[model samples]
Target: MAANKAFRFFDLPPELRGAVFSQLLVSDESIILHDTTFFTLPSAGNWNFLNVFLVNMQMYQEASAIFYSMNRFTLNAHSHRLPVHLTSRGGFLSEEGKDARRRVRNLTLYLTRVGGEFERVIGPALSDMVLNGNLRELVMRLGPPSSLGASRPPERDMEQRPPFQALLRLLADPYLEKVKLLAWKAHLAIFCPFHLRINSSRTDTESVDNQGIAILRNSTGWVELDWRAMVDVYAPGQKIVRIGDRTY
Candidate 1:
């Protein structure tokens, strides 16, 4: 009888191995992180790719970069300590960390409140990413400002909205291609594009079809989002803002 030989995954060509890694890790859908737990909104299941990194030292080095680079991560600014989490793994201390941070292209930050001292809370995370990471796109979701015994400003006061102002500073970076400011009102959600001409005085509303999704356009760009449908899908029972004829 002839002896049987074992097959080794690393024996494969580098390109083939990279292709396999991409298939398992790359996802266009956003991966969400609320506090410590991580999940995906579009696809909810017990799915994780961390094990792929634990296979071996070499695989860990290669796969970790692929995972971070290929997927967009969504984190709640108020809940998660993002900078601490990113730097805790020790990868950020070495060349791998630099590569991983540079690969990070997109991020979405959910802000529960948007007023006084808000920048102190979320500024560090944004600063680290903007200065070091190769961030191309940013999405900001502004939830209802805190109403707990404190005097909160009116919803229409754009000048006082610190988060919005922070986003404007971020958008000033020429490398950043897109920045979306999504706000949730009493029973209506508003969408605005934060761009170079964001301060320009122009507001135009595109017509909505049978569905309650409206596309708002201005000189900067257009924001087309179905907040009602999104709430039903990602956040059920949450009071979604109605799509109204408002100019941004």
Candidate 2:
């Protein structure tokens, strides 16, 4: 009887190998990421996710690039609209010299409000990484509507809120085209038993702030972002006025 040969993945051509890798690794939909994404969600010690890459160096190198580059990652947040889960370390991408973080091409932030930072993850860290890094797109879920609501506009601008300033700066970067800016209509369904059209129905006939709020409300839930309106909404604080428009 003839001896049977074992299958060797490395034996395939690099192009063919990448094609195969893409099939196994890439996802048509985004992968929702959290602090414990690569870890055990239930503490069952299943160890079945990226741990598969540990089989060998070549497999890890080849597979990781396709995975991070081809897929979209959505980083979730707590109910408070703050990403307390993603610290300065930034859990997943920040791992092992940011080999994975640098490879990321698409990222989305899910939040109830346009609030605080992921510390070093999404602030200056994002712009700095996007310089040489493969990050080509970013999306943020602007909200369901703040609990504070339009009547009580919290200090929710980029400068006042923790992450908005950094995020706005990143979106404004010439490298990232205008079309890439996207967001979901912030829903205030959580307060629905006591809900009805509030800010969403208001016309721009009111104050200047109400005008910006009107523009933002026109979005059909998830849609390409309006940077101009965003700028109007988060326009510089009194400090900037005192110093002049030089900062922006």
Highest-scoring model, TM-score:
2
Q: lDDT score, residue 117, model 1?
A: 34
Each candidate structure's TM-score, on Cα atoms with residue i matched to residue i, is 0.55, 0.64
**Per-residue lDDT over 1-248 for candidate 2, one digit per residue giving the tens place of the 0 to 100 score:** 33797778799999999998776677767776655345232322454647647779998888888877788777665256344445436565344435556667887766555454454445554565477788777775555444324433444332445565555566666454322444334432211122223466664221224323322354344544555445445544312121123455
| TM-score between candidate 2 and the true structure | 0.64
Candidate 2 positional error at 71, Å: 0.7
**How many steric overlaps are in each model, in order?**
4, 5
Clashing pairs in 2: 143-186, 143-187, 144-186, 144-187, 158-165
What does candidate 1 score on TM? 0.55
lDDT for model 1 comes to 0.53
What tens digits encode model 1's per-residue C-alpha lDDT throughout 1-248?
Answer: 33687668899998898899888877768876432223343442566667787789999878767776667877655432334543344433223344445556788876555444345535545555667776677787655344211323336654335654554455344455666656543212234322223344764544433323233333223333443343344334344332243247
After aligning candidate 1 to the native by TM-score, how far in Å is the CA of 92 from where it should be?
12
In candidate 2, residue 198 scores what lDDT? 43
